[model samples]
Target: MTALGFLYPGHSAEDDYPRIEQLLGSDIRLPLVHTDIGEDAHRVDALLEMGSAARLAAGVEELRLSGAEAVVWACTSGSFVYGWQGAHDQVRSLARTAGLPASSTSFAFAHAARELGVRRVAIGATYPDDVAALFAAFLKDAGVEVVAVRGSGIITAAEVATWDEEQVLALARAADHPEAEAVLLPDTALHTASHIQALEAALGKPVLTANQVTVWEALRLADRRVNAPRLGTLFTKEPLVQVH
Candidate 1:
């Protein structure tokens, strides 16, 4: 099996990873290790602490033992709150420690957008508006345009985990913009595996969620892809020719 390691923060909505693994099929494995999340707070200082090298490093041995071909930092807010360069540095450090390819959900969104051949996207964030704006800025640095951003102002990952399907759909709809090519729900703590199809159908466009893109990013780092149409448009076919 091609195993992908995931370093998750605290405990909320991580079950989505297993659900996605099942959907992707038996040839793949998603081994997850929970990293210490000092504070579940959505503030930048707290997030910076959460995704620290020390915390991330604490989980690499477990993943390496699981035979992971690639690793991913599955917390979106934790990664993006560090800004683009910091996030890149974070992943680089994790990769070196794990002795494998590594990425995070933040970069996953940027690459996933490119895979869909989409330049403009709208963000539906569970973070407070200030934290959400940081995500918008991170995406801009990656060359993806943020046409619109709608934040729920939720301060904690634990709170986001309690959101139901209706709320998930609402956020995507609220974040949608006429000029946007896709909608992004950027929070790893939110449960989105089961709602991807529904979210896209309701929006009449592609909806990329945190957990969805995290798995996809792991696959990309492993240099592999699989067709799982039920997961949404991003997994329906081979990677699209990237738009300039």
Candidate 2:
């Protein structure tokens, strides 16, 4: 079994990993390290905007201490709010901190989209329009076009976590455009892995959610190839290329 580590901001392990485990079947082991970055709303935006290298480094080190082969910074806004260059630097800093392969949820989205050969994407976010704009720009820099975007104007991470699957699917279906080849729902706090298959069935296209891409990217880094159809089309479909 391949072991992968997830660094979450402020969510419980019980709520996060079950879907991933279900998607990967009963074979893979995912150990998560939860950091309480979301408790203080005042510092949340600052931490995300200015780049919390020290805190992020601490989180990565904790995951490494827990025997993680590879670590992923699981917060989307925490990484992408820094813009393209800042995001790249954050990943490099994480790699240095953990002394292992490191990636962020934002980076995973880009890599997943690129690997799947998806050119145009519709984005659904639970953030303000400005924050969503930053995410869209980051994807554009990665060669994916943002055909459409919708934001839920949600502020708190806890509120986002409380969002049910029906709400998320409704938002995704409403946000999707006919021209878009894929729909990206990028917020790690939201429970997206559980809703991916349903969203794909509704949209009739691939749906890349935050946790899905994060897990997939971590597995890719660890040299684990999973073909769990219940997860969604991405995993069931052949990888666009072999990383090795």
lDDT of 2: 0.81
| Candidate 1 per-residue lDDT over residues 1-244, each given as its tens digit | 7999999999999999999998987599999999999988999899999999999999999999999999999988889988999999999999999999999999999999999889999999998999999999999999999999998989989999999999999889988999999999999999999999999899899999999999999999988879998899999857676422
Model 1 bad stretches (over 4 Å): 242-244
The digit string of per-residue lDDT tens for model 2 on 91-135 reads 898888888998888999998887788999999998878888889
What's the distance in Å from true for residue 239, model 2? 1.7
Candidate 1 at residue 144, lDDT?
A: 95
Backbone clashes counted, model 2: 0
Tell me how far candidate 2 lies from the true structure as C-alpha RMSD in angstroms: 2.2
Q: What's the lDDT for residue 127 in model 2?
A: 82
TM-score of 2: 0.93
